[model samples]
Target chain A: DAGITQSPRHKVTETGTPVTLRCHQTENHRYMYWYRQDPGHGLRLIHYSYGVKDTDKGEVSDGYSVSRSKTEDFLLTLESATSSQTSVYFCAISESNQGREQYFGPGTRLTVT
Target chain B: AQTVTQSQPEMSVQEAETVTLSCTYDTSESDYYLFWYKQPPSRQMILVIRQEAYKQQNATENRFSVNFQKAAKSFSLKISDSQLGDAAMYFCAYRSARNQGGKLIFGQGTELSVKP
Candidate 1:
């Protein structure tokens, strides 16, 4: 309900192929995040952006890169998809006044074969 | 490094009954925030409740409440008169007070099943 949207709800790709996931928010929030969910690991942060062209690596940023060229759009790119990268990815946005209650998009289920 | 821990991998509660989910976090910052998010079968993360560390009073929404013990470094969620719709995966999350980017550290989740 936070006006967040993620493109390509589902994707399947072969190993060594490149994949990109996009997140767009209509609320124009300044904070955007990318997270991946896997069994035994609830959700791990992959990357986040605070402003246009301002990004930072998260705990599991290895093999993943993100870019925020505009306030409402953030993109996550996997240079070479690997089987280990198969998981459900979520995009979230938050307003500074909300104090960390992030509004999440539905999610993207990616499978790498 | 701040970390959130949810020990219960799965839980079950009867309709109209009460249930409590345990969550513990380790953080060096005195001022921070804790949150409980519910992810249904649809896998969409929804915010259920939130607690601020600086506040001594526990936070409560309609049927959901939290037992925030700062001394014990514990933040547990309690659902009273649980309903069937409560069935979902519950996650505990932590965020620093000094940060404004809304970066969260999540715990391993607890899958809750509500029975009739």
Candidate 2:
């Protein structure tokens, strides 16, 4: 278990509402990633941060945004929720020397009505 | 661009038996990494094994082992003496060796059921 946790394990929000999910890690890892899991799609990267205040878009970055102000915290926000955004979101982290072997958090299930 | 594909959507194996899951990836780069991640009912992604493309020998972790065929671009996972705990969704992922933020391309997934 990597010391990673995602707040609001589950949530239901209406369409067009703003929602933000938080990922907190204690390992002080330099790499943090956000992914969404859906049926038939194992998991798709949403966004990732390499260090404090440095971020990049992933394969599926539309409708989502991320910010990393500190090493331990990463935030993913949905500016306006939509039905297509309903899915399980996961947070993962890896050390600088570990290459791409990432450890994942428990995950957050968000529903858009 | 890199892509990973898991042809089997579902598979089942009897307890104590051996089962192999198939994975194939497409990449122009010769240097990269392949990984198998297990997601149980708890929904936690656990790293089962990994193989570096440059290595000729296969990689193994306890009961989990990988058959890496670089020329064929195939990576398969073999589970020996399978147990109930092995029942879960298995995912195969590919990452380039280049320092491109270590992004990973994942397969759809294969749901593995272990019969006890």
- Identify the leading candidate in terms of DockQ: 1
Name the regions of candidate 1 deviating beyond 4 angstroms: none
Q: Write the per-residue lDDT of candidate 2 for residues B1-116, one digit (tens) a residue.
A: 88899999999999999999999999999899999999999999999998989899999999999999999999999999999999999999998888778877899999999999
> For each candidate, C-alpha RMSD in Å?
1.1, 1.0
Interface RMSD of 2: 1.7
lDDT for each residue of candidate 2 in A2-113, tens digit (9 for 90 to 100): 8999999999999999999999999989999999999998899999899999999999999999999999999999999999999999999988523459999999999999
- Candidate 1 lands at a TM-score of 0.98
lDDT of each: 0.93, 0.94
lDDT of 1 by residue, B1-116 (tens): 98989999999999999999999999888989999999989888999999999899999999999999998999999999999889999999998888646789999999999999
For model 2, the superposed segments whose C-alpha errors exceed 4 Å read: A97-100
Clashes per candidate, residues 3 or more apart or on different chains: 0, 0
DockQ (Cα-based) for each candidate: 0.67, 0.62
Q: Candidate 1 falls in which docking quality class?
A: medium
